[model samples]
Every structure is written in structure tokens, then in C-alpha cells.
Target: MKQNSLRATVRARLSGLHDAEARVAHVVLDQGAQLVHLSVSDVARLAGTSASTVVRSCRRLGFGGYQELKIAAAREAPPEPRDELDPLTATVRAAQEALGGLPATLSRTDLSSAAEALSGADRVLMAATGLSGAIAVDAAYRLRALGLPVDLPPDPLTAHLAAELLPQRSVCLAISHSGATRTTVETARRARAAGAKVVTITSYASSPLAEESTWVLLGGGQDLVFGMEAVASRLAHLTIVDTLSMILLGLGGGRSERAVSASAEVTADHSY
Candidate 1:
């Protein structure tokens, strides 16, 4: 018999759960298909929570018991055999699913705070390296469109120097998917040491970049579409930039409208 899917429903309720139940939920959510076969005790050991906690969490999800949870999980598991879809369809579906989870994972309050920080900063220096550097540049342009003072240099050394020179009320926002990018992390650290606020846009909340940040804006959803260079991460970062831009615009009043209009007029003649 078919059972209602609980994976999505359970994840949505994770924050409302008790610590022990939440831990068990994280294990189940992270393990996904693998959990379908793991015994309750096995999951307890992996989540570092007790088997009773797992059972309780399952019950909270409306399951009659752990066995019911496993049964439902198996029923809702991804289509058997990984290669069920053609290559193109699989790629598109993967990207879609990764992007689709953003709405649930991202925090509106955190994003709003980040936007305010950027909008109210004395100066803004955005930093990243390699692929993420491109994202930094894009964010700089988007912020600049609102007439906000934004700087993003392609050179890592120059970017580092800019961060080190940031004064009070200034901000250095670093973009990194892994939060472990060495140059970006160091740049953020130097900026914070220089008396500037440091903001990090990353996927991991506990990463080094996040640790160095005064505020963190999560990109929402995992960026496993293709690893570090995954296009999905870039999309996530861009979404964050766009969200901040809109918030800043709303807070800017008439001034931001004028800036955007002026930018559009200037570029209008250059476009086909």
C-alpha cells in the first residue's frame, strides 16, 4: 500500500522540533534514500541521538512508528536505478530540485538584515576568488546600479588590501559556496580586524567564512549540482544579490529609483 510522503513535510517542521528530535530529523533528511534501509538504532547512532528520539520524531511526522516511517520513505524514494532518466532530463531535474529547496531553507529575517547592512554601510567591498569572483563582480554591479558605493576587484591581493583598509561602518561581503575558500576567508578576517562589518554569503552556516562574519546570508539549498564549480551555487548567490538589491531599493526611497532609471537610460543606447 502507498503511504503519504513525509520527507518534505518533516523537513518543514524540523525547526519546531525539540533538539533531540531535530537531530534525528536532520539525519533522516540528510540520509534520504539511505535511511529507507537503516534500522531505527542505526539512525540513532548516526545522528548521535537515541533510538527513542528517532521514534518520537517519526511519530511527530504522523507515522505510527519507526517501521511506518521506513516504509513510507521507501515508497517515496527516488525512482529506482539512478539512470532512469536520460542525461539531459536528469541534469535539468537536478538543477530544478536544488533551486526549488531555496524557499524553505533561506531565512527572510537574515536576508533582510544583510540587505540593511549593505544599504547602510559607509563603503562596501565584495570579495571572492575564482568562480565565486565572477559572482562577486555581478553583485557589485547590481549594488552599484542602486548608486550604492560598491567595490569588487578581480585581483585577490587588491581585494585583500581593500578589505584591510575598510573603516568603521564599512562592510566586506564575501561570497563562497563552501565557506572554506582560503582567500575569501582571510579577506573577511582582515576586514573585520580593520573595524569593518563582515558579511558572508555561503551555503554552510558553520564554515570558516561564516565564523569570520558579523552576519551571514545563506544561499539556501545545497549546491551539489556539479561540485564547487556547480552552476547551481552561482544561481543561488545571484538570487541572494538580487534579493538584497530589491530590499535596498525599497529602503532607498526616491533616490534609488532615480539611480536605477539613470543607469537604464545610460545603457539603453548601448543595447540592441
Candidate 2:
């Protein structure tokens, strides 16, 4: 099976397992390649579980033993080939991997909730910082083109103000790959306090932004050679945004068709 599919399976099964098994599973899913070099006892110790439990967990996942499970996981894992590629190719590949990782990470429930929020909102506000700020603007523009009332805050202060001004029954959507952006988290908290529903698209569901959100969208992440390169996390976040846009379009029904047509007509006058 593809790595993405395997990841989905692991996530789906995670919560169903007992705590010890869950911890073991998390270690395997989160650090699969690293685990290949560790013995069963070492992995068990890392997960705070007994070695026998680790073996049982491996069996539950269809592996005959812990070693087999590690081998399978390593085979499905993405190659960290940064050193083998030129700068441009590595950068492009990282983005591509991130995009590829999106579908499995996102949940249908989250997408549906986001669509409902957008459809019911008086207005929608999106905010991000740095590279994510550009993505927020693009998402806002797309939603606007689809006839949704959307805004993108220009700065952290403006974002906070916008969050505070969110009326009851409105929606505020925050985008952050790290899920630790202080401004975004604070804005989301304020929006929620103001009685507007808040949605967060982020790489970590356990992140602070997720803690403040009514709806949480998941994305994927990959280690990168440099912090500046657009790696898997950014691409995953963009894909989540794109998926949310599509969901909103579907929710708008006939209005979406008209809005898209208008956008096409407006774009016809512009050239590269």
C-alpha cells in the first residue's frame, strides 16, 4: 500500500488501541524510520510500554513480529533524499511531497464542518503570518470569487482587531502550519470568546490553535534541510485550504456556478 494509505490506517486505529498500544503505535507512525534501528525493548521503553505489548501491537497491525513491522514501515516511508538532489529539485520535491500528503491527513468531518461554517457565517476572516500570510490572502480571494464574504487581515494587530469584531454567528478561519503561531492562536481565542465559530487548519491537531478551535483541519509535515524552504507542511496546509474552498463551493450550490463564471470573465482581461 502507499505510505499515505498506511498513515491513514494508523491514524484510524490509533484511538481504538489501549493507551500503551496507542503510545507504541504513535512512535511507529511518527518515527518509523528511526525505529528501524532500535530493538523491540528500546522501542517499548520509548513508548513506555512493555516489550510484549509492542510485539502484540505489531501483530495487530498485521506484522508477524516487531522486526517485520519496522521493515514494512521503512519500505513505505519517504526517502529523505535532500543530499542527493540539487537545491531546486529538493525544494520542488519537498513541496510535492507535502501536497501528496494532504488527502490522507484531512478528515471528511472537518471539511464538512468548515463548509457549514462558511455557509452560515455573516462573514469570514482568514489570517496568517509570513509565508502563510500570502496563502491566507489567496484563500480569501478564492472564497470571495466564489461569492463568500471573506477578508484577509493585513497584519497581526489588524488580525486581532478583526477577530475581536467577529459578530455572533460569523466564522473566523486561521491558517498556520506550525499551529504555534502566537498571533493566530490569540486571534482564534478572541474570536471564540466573541461567540464566532473558529476553524483552524494546522499540521498538529494537538496544537494550541486546535485547542482554541471549534473545527480542526489536519495537514502533514516533513523535516527540511532549511527552515526557509517550502516543505511538506506548507503544501499540506495549502491543500487543506484548497479542499475547504471546494467544500464551500459545493455548499453554495447554484451561486457557486455564477460566481465562478464571473471570475472567469474578469480573469479574461488579464495576461501573464
Candidate 3:
């Protein structure tokens, strides 16, 4: 097959993997085909586990050993042929599949809880880093357009400090594709510590950030072959943000409509 079944296989076996094995699996899963590039030791260091755990995790996924797993990764990452689908085509297909599967991955109960929390929150603090930072900023802007109180901290320290001050009725929206980002996870922890409801948007269901979240809005369908671990699907994250924004706007009544109109009009003055 052009696209290997390794990712699917690892995901299927995720819960059954022991803690160290799960950590190793996360490393493998997050890295995508890039897992073929790393030595067992490198993966172990990244996953914060031993090389033996990495070997065991691969074996648990039904591979004979780590080399077998790497071979599977290599097969999935062969160079594109001139007659075959291009990089863009592959990416589009993956995204289409991911979007198609989004409904199955997202929980209706969690969506309701997240929407209700944001709509009624006293404050909404957004925390993210790297590319996820941009998503948080966009979300903050949209939330503010509805006259909802939202804060987007500029950096990790500010996010940490701001999260600590979130009132009991506040909501902290944490976005991270891997869900293991240290600063983002820490920020969510601090927000929960202050009694705010933490909502996480992440691909990894069992990430540290999810552990810190009161509501986990898990989303995935992103597969950028080269950037599987480094950069996930921007469209997928934005879709989740849009979904939540729509919910808040839908439930906010006539006042929210006016706020959106006013916000648009104010911005239109600067445009043509």
C-alpha cells in the first residue's frame, strides 16, 4: 500500500501498551515515517524511555522488533514517483480522511461541555506555543468578536501567570498537536489549579495536556508526511476552533449577533 498501516496499527494498540511502551509508541506515532530515521536510542531519549522499551513497544505493535517497525516506516515513506500522486495530493487525501473521521473522534458530550463552559465563562484564557500559538490567537480574536472575555498570552511565562489568575468560572483553551508541549501542558495545569475549566484541543488523546484538561477536545486527521510530528494539520485545528466558535455564537442570543456585526463593521472601516 502507498500509505502504510503502521500508524493505524500503533493507534489500535495504544491503550494496551504499558506506560513505557506507550511513551515509545507516542514517539513512533508522532514521528510518523520519520521514525525510520532515528536510532532506537534516539527514540528512547525522545520518548523518555529506555531503548528496550522502544523495542518492546514495536514488538507489541506486532513487529518482530524495532528494525521491523522501521522497515514499515521506510516503506510508508518511499520517494514520490513521477507517475504517482504528488506530495500535495497525498496531503489532501490525508486531510480529507481526517476531516471525514473527525466526527467519530470528537465526543458530543465533550463538545457540549466545552461550548457551555465557554459561553458562560467569566474569562477565557488561551495558551499555546509555536504554530498552535497562532490558532490560539485566532480563537481569542473570534471569541472577543462575540464580546466574550478572552486572553491570549504572548509567551510561556505570561501564559503561566495568566492561567494562574483565571477565576473559578473561567475557561482555558489549550491547543497542542502532540499534547506534550511542556509550556502548554504546564499552563493548562496552572489553569486547572486555579479552578478554571481547561479545554484541550490535541491529536494525542492520552497526552499530558489531556491529563490536565477538564474537557478534552481530541482532534486528528492530519498527515503531512515530512511534518507529521513537527507540524500537524492547520485546517483540522482551525476546524475545531471554528466549531467551538459557532457553538458559542449560536448559544449567545441576539446580543452576540450584534457584537459580531459591530466587530465586523469596526474592522471594515480599515478595509475597502
TM-score of each: 0.75, 0.77, 0.72
- The residue pairs that clash in candidate 1, if any, are none
Alpha carbon lDDT of each predicted model: 0.74, 0.76, 0.79
Predicted structure 2: lDDT: 0.76
Q: Write the per-residue lDDT of candidate 1 for residues 1-272, one digit (tens) a residue.
A: 23223443454345457888878888777766666779999999988888888898888755788887777677654533435767566555545544554554557888888788888888999889877888888888888889788888768798889987887899898998778889999899989999988878776555778889988776533323345235655676788788888899998777789889988998997999
Q: Using TM-score, give the best candidate's number.
A: 2
Score candidate 2 by TM-score against the native. 0.77
> Could you arrange the candidates by TM-score from highest to lowest?
2, 1, 3
Candidate 1 deviant stretches above 4 angstroms? 1-39, 45-81, 220-229
Ranking 1 against 2 by TM-score, winner:
2
Against the correct fold, how does model 1 do in TM-score? 0.75
Cα distance off (Å), candidate 2, residue 204: 1.5
RMSD of each: 6.1, 5.0, 7.7
Model 2 steric clash pairs:
none
Q: How many Å off is the CA of 241 in candidate 2?
A: 1.8
By summed lDDT, the worst window of 10 consecutive residues in model 3 runs over: 75-84
For model 2, the superposed segments whose C-alpha errors exceed 4 Å read 4-39, 45-81
- Tens digits of lDDT, candidate 3, 109-188: 99988999999999999989988888888899989998799889888999999988888999999998878899999999
